[model samples]
Target: MNAGPSTAAGSAELRGEPPLVVDLDGTLCYSDTLWEALLLFLKHHFWQAWRLPLWLLLGKAGFKAALAGRIALDPGALPYDQTLQRELEHQRAQGRRLVLATGADQRWAERLAAHLGPFEQVLASAGGVNLTSRAKADALVRLYGAHGYDYIGNSRADLAVWQSSRHAYSVTRKPFRLADGRHTEHIGSVRPQPLAALWRAMRPRQWLKNLLVFVPMLAGHALNAGALAQSLLAFAAFSLCASSAYLLNDALDAHDDRRHPDKRRRPLAAGTLPLPLALAASPLLALGAFTLCALFDPLLLAVVGIYLAATLAYSLRLKRMLMIDIVTLALLYTVRILGGCAATLIAPSFWLLAFSFFVFLSLALLKRYSELFNLHSRGQDKSSGRGYTVADKAPISIMGINSAFLSVLIFMLYFNSQTVLTMYRHPYFLLGIVPLLVFWLGRLWTLAFSGQVNEDPVLYVSRDKVSLTVLALCFGLALAAT
Candidate 1:
């Protein structure tokens, strides 16, 4: 259905009106099909990602052609600009010939044209030459001659075509009227303010997880200016790394996230944040993290690198692997504590590391349990975008509770260890931590079982008043023992 500009003019003449040509990416739709295909490529055929730059060397049109050939996007699922659609339908009803003219590969443009149905003709890139800017203008002029067609487009690249058109309909964030007597109608509503959406995407509140990097200083009783500075640097490095991981996760999950009620509103899934920006920011943030860690200690940098690798694995594949996903999540938390140890040059104690692993394992299971609960409540049989089934809920609850109890046992054993006796003035004061932990764990599990927990367990604890009070009491007791 990709008809040339001449076909558009012929069709326009038969309809007795100028054809309406609409830009696809960023104009008729809020998203770019190229970026969409790229993400889909990474998600399903990730191994083929290294081939991307090679394809781009041929040119943007060739790159897009190669990518579009590999992935078939469901046009009905795309986030189209509803206002534009309504306006196009009105014009279509008035006997205007509608044409979909875009720089996107002809395959996707054709698919979308058929899916959306307003476009009688699709004018798009066939191969080497991208149909944009001057090329687009020439094609329009060849078909309809000077000022014989109307162009609706977004971005500066569209200005060339707009200038050649009888009427210029712009989709822009800023407002202005055409002064050269070319008629224009501004389309699209005021875009949603992005600052709040960006903040949510960064998930600043989740930075609390990086506080684990301070645990080594606290455990080593080295709370001096030097140790505090080291710990702060570690916190910054880990926070940056964590944010980078979150950005990558959101980008990769954008496809599935759109299907979730709450997650659909995420910056990437909702198209509030552009995909190219997210892709660029991820690596820059990771580099900043590595730089901070390198300045602190090479060993710290190494640990941060491993943490990033593990997280990337989790985001890419491990998250789909059933019970292994929870175990990997636990390991990720324990690695943060290890990062703290490296930052402060403290030797990790087996008792503390073991305790961290088991506790975090329980919390990880709680996260999955919460997700399952959400699905079960909605009468769904299985967790969406996950491997877990609703039938496994009881077993997960049992395993989570067992892991929690095991962490408490490890803490009790640590109190009886020679290390505790050597490091503490009053070792028995540490015993109080066990009961406090028991109560907190029990409360958390009880809440999760009743389907009251929707957030990650770590995040839940950070915001809960009771959890905060228990944490303070546990810290006070540990300080008393020290």
Candidate 2:
């Protein structure tokens, strides 16, 4: 909703007019407190989620009250409709009384009213009564008579109340037309780019990590047509499952993401992608992933299932644990290589697993180091959701650098192994990759120290020219050795 002040002037014409009534969810605020509270509850109490159905059996009002009592959503951090808020403030400045009527819990309604305005009264669901639709219309009519006050709303449920109001002002995607010939005007419209927002929410750029699923086939020199085809299928399945996990993670973190400087612009956190739509899309993506995996092989499906499970565990609980988060991230990366081995029917190499684990661990720690470095630069001591502080940044960098060198040593040892002698005609060419790895890792750490890397290192590598050059040279060296 992005209407300008000129649109608000229309309401000024009604001098000494009746009090203005405003809807809460989707009208005054860009998000629904009820849905946000429910998500927060599920996020924190996932182990006790059975309580949700039992609470809902208490009815909508009772369910909302129960959630409100359990979780306290921060009112100040909510994404309010700024344009509509300006209009409300203008009306208030004009001395017109304002009433906040919402289907959200009474506590949330009063909290928002106190936080954002001069509402004379707050009417919301309470004491087992869900004050919405017809009930809200009746209550307003009882207090101010039919057609005595103007109304502003943004959903079909508010149509009943609009029918009983003096005038209708809408902020929905489409304007409302009353059949009773009452005046109606569109104040604003929530015209989001649904397809673009959905695509962004999927985080397709992060799918680059799924390319690791091809490593096993490439490493074992299994580039036959069938092996290539199976590996491609495995990559697709992993990408889809990864996307599903990303969506769920974003939905769960939307509240806290809104407080982070960079993450706040994400689709779910910024309200560009609706929470309900994101939640619905996540399971469908996972189902599609499993279907693809099944078409390849049951073994491949089992591997993808484990990856999904680990990802869900990380998103749900492991991400907040101290060093466990980084370890989990590294293992998730290694799982992609394992998936490739399953797809290509290749025996996994101990050397490949060891090298990948340490390299990815280094990358994961680099990511956390960047985050904490940024926080420290901002004069903040602690990360929002993770278990890290500014003081941990130095040690994190040291650990990450050591891990990178350890991966290099593993790669050197793998070159000396019989496996490398049988696979590569000129095994010495592979040693050139070591210096490139060292240079890239050193430069990455330097960039992190200088605050040049501010996001996922994998993502940053995709865009960094130096990193890309290093990767291209590494691939060239491997091809030469083969």
Candidate 3:
């Protein structure tokens, strides 16, 4: 976002004119400090969220102060608007006074001012009174008199303060109506369209993982139209649940994710998606998923509940454990098959369970291995939010390859079983599947080791022409055996 031409009175302020007061949240910074405080509170002091209403009953200022005291907000890591920062610097160079006025707690406001280094004064929430709207307007009016200072802000709450200012500049493209005939210019187009950012934050691409919900129906050859419809419903529920988990993870991991080159562009980390919106959407999505699951089948709903619990646990803690992390990921994948079984009333098969564990474990290990490889290439020794290190690269590779081979062994054992003979008229034809599995697994690991498999292994296979062809051949072989 860039600044537009300032009004004559606003531009005159560049030559030692009246003070310029800038709102902090959504004006000076792309993200809101209040939302940052809320996220930090939920991430570290989650138990305190229940007490927020009680504190707010006392007042907004007191609530903000209480929350801000507990959160360790890093001012330097905040998503400040680059254009606003540059404009502030330019105004500073001209010896113009800059004041930061915000409804955010004074503690956070001070830290931000200290970090940014241009603000001469910070007027913010304090003493149980929230400094916003009318309060802010009154304070500025008392300090600088009506129309004595130029104000810059974004939200509608800023309208009250802008009414008292000499001129207004904003971070929004929407024209601010000035009843008092004061000039208003849009300084930059900073915030993303809320609906679009929310959609992106849901991460539609990752929903591909939920297709695992159809595994059991396909494997059992019971995929008639009715079963297909049920599986589709199950798929939708899992997708919603998965998106909820992802939003929770992204919000909690925002600080760490910002340090990563690729992850920094994620909506939450980039400050394009509002943190409050993410927080609101997560539980709503989870509820919607559970509701849909309940309407389908109680057993399926229970399985989905377990999946959500396990996923949340993984995001909160298990993901940091060494082998346990990968094991949990494997279980999460296997649960999808369980969900499918419940949806279709298919009895659980040991072969399918074992195969899923081994395969997904290998893929999970590949994910970590790729992360370590990237860190190694960057001269970093540790993987963020993970127990793995650059030195553990060889072990991860060995384990991933071995796990993949173990899955192949499971497939071979399944083919040799009496169950295979009972199910297939010509079970011998299934031997063709073994070589395909071997080739796919071998090629997958080779690419991962060579840093070619940089995305989720499932997503990789979905996009890879070679993997797709091998998969088709394997399916054909299985059909011939049956």
Per-model TM against the reference: 0.89, 0.96, 0.93
lDDT of 2 by residue, 1-482 (tens): 24543355565653477889999887787778888898888789998898999999999999999999998888876777776787777878777788998999999899889999679899999999898999999989999999988888877788899999977888766667676866456664454776788899899988899999889988898879999899999989998999899989998898889989999888888876777888899999999999988876899999999999999999999999999999999999999999999999998999999999999999999999999988888889999888988889878889999999999999989988999999999889999999999999989988888989866999999999989999999999999999
Candidate 2: residue 444 lDDT (0-100)? 90
The reply for model 1, stretches above 4 Å from the true place, is: 1-17, 89-97, 175-185, 192-199
Scored by lDDT, model 3 comes in at 0.86
Question: In candidate 2, what residue range of length 10 has the lowest lDDT sum?
Answer: 1-10
Clashes of 3: 0
Model 2 TM: 0.96
Please give the RMSD of candidate 3 to the true structure.
2.3
User: Residue by residue across 52-134, what tens digits does model 3's lDDT show?
Assistant: 88878877788898888788689977777887788778788767898999998989899889999999999999998799999
Instruction: Give the top-scoring candidate (TM-score).
Output: 2
Cα lDDT over the full model 1: 0.85
lDDT of every predicted structure (CA atoms)? 0.85, 0.88, 0.86
Q: What tens digits encode model 1's per-residue C-alpha lDDT throughout 1-482?
A: 13222344453433676888999998887778899988888988998789998998989899999998899987865667776787677667667799999999999999999989878899999858799989998999999898898888877788788888986777766633444755355675445655666667888889999999899899989989988888888899999999899989998888788777788778888777777877888898999999987775899999999999999999988898889899999999999999989888989999989999999999999999988888888888876568899898899989999999999999998899999999999988999999999999999999998988774888888889999999999999999998
What's the lDDT for residue 476 in model 1? 98
- Residue pairs with backbone atoms closer than 3 Å in model 2 (clashes): none
Model 1 compared with the native: what TM-score?
0.89
Supply the global lDDT for candidate 2. 0.88
